[model samples]
Target: MSTKINELSVVDADKFTVSRTITIAAPIEKVWAAVTEAQHIARWFPEHATLSPLAVGTTGVFGWSDHGDFPVRIEELDPPHMIAYRWGNSNAAASTLESGETTVFRFTLETVDAGTQLTVVESGFDALRDPAASMDGNRGGWDFELDELVAYLEGSE
Candidate 1:
């Protein structure tokens, strides 16, 4: 099967932030839930996930068999429009944002004639122990995971 690849751009070399954007063939609400809700998120992004209420300060955890669990907390939420989270370090055993080894993950959705435009921007790589390697890893991670999201959502319809 042919795969859809999202566009990735390095926003700042010094800050180590990268942005990825992909258009999916689904409504904004559906896309929002797929990104925010634990069940839908697990289908695409993580092996397993648990999210609290859709509000700021709500905490969650994303688990991968290899990486174990990474703690996450909602820093911002706007229903079907935007959601942002502070997630623990990918390269370390950080369970809290207070550990000072975390990154910001922001997902923004926009309605369009075709479907929804989803943009994911993950920053704070400079705080990691190995910024370059971490940026490369997450960049590839988003490319693979977002394609799974499109396939899951579009194929389900």
Candidate 2:
């Protein structure tokens, strides 16, 4: 058997930007709710999330249904439109870098004829304490997570 791992985008490249678009067959409202609401988010993004959707700074902790916890700070919010945040990768702690050095994650919702066009962009990673190994792992991880988002929206387990 071969012992090689697949990468999605590369984590420690000179550039740091990862963006993807997924069209959901539901209305913008549904997609927005799935992303904003704590319960809805828990269903797709995390297993549990404590969210404060007020007009000010909101925050929450998202973790896997069984393991992991990533604290998120809401930077911007607009109903059925956009939600931006600073996402701290809890799993990043496993590495030798500062876990607090977060990468920005943004999710925008647009009403399209096909439904809602959700765009996700993550950036801010010029350097990693452990460049070579970490980059590949992170790149692959994000790709898998994005695929999970699609499956979650598709209501497929």
Candidate 3:
């Protein structure tokens, strides 16, 4: 199977949401695990990750060597179909979910002949001091991280 790159798009300039979609050559269950499970997430995205039970209101942290851990809360969860997290804003110091300076990351999955179509939409960039820059940074980030995820899953298979 061939690898695929994520398609990036801006939801709206004023809203400052970055959306990305990638098709992976793996089953929906495998893709869901990679996106939700800490062990699988650490292998592809964050340098380190700790996720609580996969349910609404559960919290977690995703850490990078350069940037410290960022608090994350499960805002929405729907089995192997969808999961959404409200995470700390990259521009501010790591903070709690109650803090207004947080962003939303929603991931939706659909089974396809290729395997799964994963669409990730991260919003709330407008809440940050520098919306444009943050949106641009995360656009590149999702591109790299999702591509890494595809590589990890395909390689292991």
The sequence of per-residue lDDT tens digits that candidate 3 reaches over residues 42-146 is: 999899999978889988999999877889999999989999999987785446677687889999999998899999999988777778888888888888888
Better of 1 and 3 by TM-score: 3
lDDT of each: 0.85, 0.65, 0.85
Best by TM-score: 3
lDDT of 3 at 66: 88
- Candidate 1: list runs displaced more than 4 Å: 1-5, 8-11
In candidate 3, which residue pairs clash? none
Model 2 weakest lDDT span, ten residues long: 1-10
Whole-model alpha-carbon lDDT for candidate 2: 0.65
lDDT-better candidate, 1 vs 2 = 1
On lDDT, the stronger of 1 and 3 is 3
Note the residue pairs that clash in candidate 2. Answer: none
lDDT, model 2, position 58: 74
**How does candidate 1 fare on TM-score?**
0.90
What range of 10 consecutive residues in model 3 has the weakest lDDT sum?
2-11
lDDT tens digits, residue span 70-128, model 2: 77778777776988877664335542223655666778999877667777776655433
